[model samples]
Target: MRRSQRKQEEPDLGVLAGRTLFGLQRELFTRLGEVGHPDVRPRHGAVLAYLDEEGSRATDLAAQSGQHKQVIGTLVDELVELGYVRRQPDPADRRAKLIVPTDKGLDHMAKSDAILAGMEAEHARAVGEEAYAEFKRVFRLVADRHSGR
Candidate 1:
């Protein structure tokens, strides 16, 4: 095969997928800023959402968010300092701690949801509502399959 043909045959799916996802994340974060939640970044938002949904330990959040434990710990500390979240002693396991979002965190979550809803509406407008819904369904299926869930 010619060089060009070989290049075409070797699709860099991993690179392309990562670039696409990163681009979308950047765009979403920009929109979030526009929506007046400028202080919240994608990573912080992910941690908040995880705590809101599952209320896991710091170690678990680190694993689930694919962030280093120390990184998550630092972020959690920041969140705590900002009064968005608090760490309380776990009743079941005294030695362990459970991270819970404060009222401020919940408020932030509501704003984040509003921003994401606006983004989703824009996406539906661009791609059609039905198509967007189907895309989400298929994407979730693919994600679940890959994660063995």
Candidate 2:
């Protein structure tokens, strides 16, 4: 069939991935709102995604999240004000500060983890665990390829 003549039944893979993630984030934000974080937004997910259990410097987070230092700094300030994250002097370097998740942030992380786990379990049940595992492996391979690993 000619390119123009062929019907497009679904979005391309990139669109599918972006839309699916957006939907998941919407669901997460809604759940968080229900759990007492009505102010949390998907934009903050960029900062939250890079934060570790131990903590990291704002520059590192900005690099990982592909955001400007000023932007990440502002987001960190907001997160601090919201009680989701705190800035503490980095022991390794006093000149730098580490962005650490507060107890509230960790609790939110736990809840978010549970929500994703439930979604994964539901997907596995629908697709079969073996198939789901294979899918995960394939996805990882694709990611590794993109990362030149």
Candidate 3:
């Protein structure tokens, strides 16, 4: 079979997931740029998406974001420089620091939440709410099963 013909076959789960993730990230970052966060890049999502309002430790963020601790540290430093996050002493442990989002980061987080909701609504509308819900449920189950979580 020709390479072109092989390429035309239905995509495997990895290809489909990667393509979907790419599209979602592109749309999300573009929308975020329009909302006064032009400096926020797709890579920043690794930190922002997993962050909590109360703040979290670098180790926790690294585990949640599936990024190396060094990478998380670099991203946190960049965010601090960008005025999106600040490091504060962890109340529970004076020896540890917590990554807390600034006001700008909170605003960005709200906007991102709304934009993602709208995107999900659009998809649900296109494919029916029930079907979309089922798709998400199945996808999450498979993801969890593979991740051993």
Candidate 4:
């Protein structure tokens, strides 16, 4: 193939991957909402997921979530208002506060996990199991490399 044609034919894999992942996440969140869960924005979900994995200070969550501290603090305030999370005095630093998920937040995560499992099953069915497995493996490899892990 001519160099121009070869270059033209090269896949925009990054864009494709981003679109697919975002679509899947949107669909999963939509299904979750349909199941009567409050409409939490994707950013809030990221915050909740992060807190679930490891409770951290608002600044840490801001950095990890790629959101500004003000943005994260606002989101945390919303979560607290919704009774999904709480801010407690940090033992490591008396002046800092740690974000912790409430029982409600944990329960929401359990429900979200079930919804995500169903979505994953559908995705595997749509893209054959082998393809899904390979995609996951390759994606993880790329992620690990990018993160220097």
Q: Where does candidate 2 clash, by residue pair?
A: none
User: Model 4: per-residue lDDT, tens digit, 29-97?
Assistant: 787677766567677865776674446898888766767899999999998988888999988988988
Better of 3 and 4 by TM-score: 3
lDDT of each: 0.77, 0.85, 0.93, 0.79
The digit string of per-residue lDDT tens for model 3 on 1-149 reads: 87656655877788888999999999999999998999999998889999999998999999888899999999999999999999999999999999999999999999999999999999999999999999999999988887778
Estimate the Cα RMSD of every predicted model relative to the unseen true structure. Answer: 3.5, 2.5, 1.2, 3.7
State which candidate has the highest lDDT. 3
Off by over 4 Å in 4: 1-11
lDDT value for model 3: 0.93
* lDDT: the better of candidates 1 and 2: 2
Which portions of model 3 miss their true places by more than 4 Å? Answer: none
- Residue-level lDDT of model 1, residues 1-149, one tens digit each, is 88767656874656556776787778777876776556777678557767754356998887677788898998998888878789988778989998888876777777767766877898899999999999889878977776678
Candidate 4, TM-score vs. the true structure? 0.77
Which order, best to worst by TM-score?
Answer: 3, 2, 4, 1
Each model's TM-score?
A: 0.74, 0.85, 0.96, 0.77
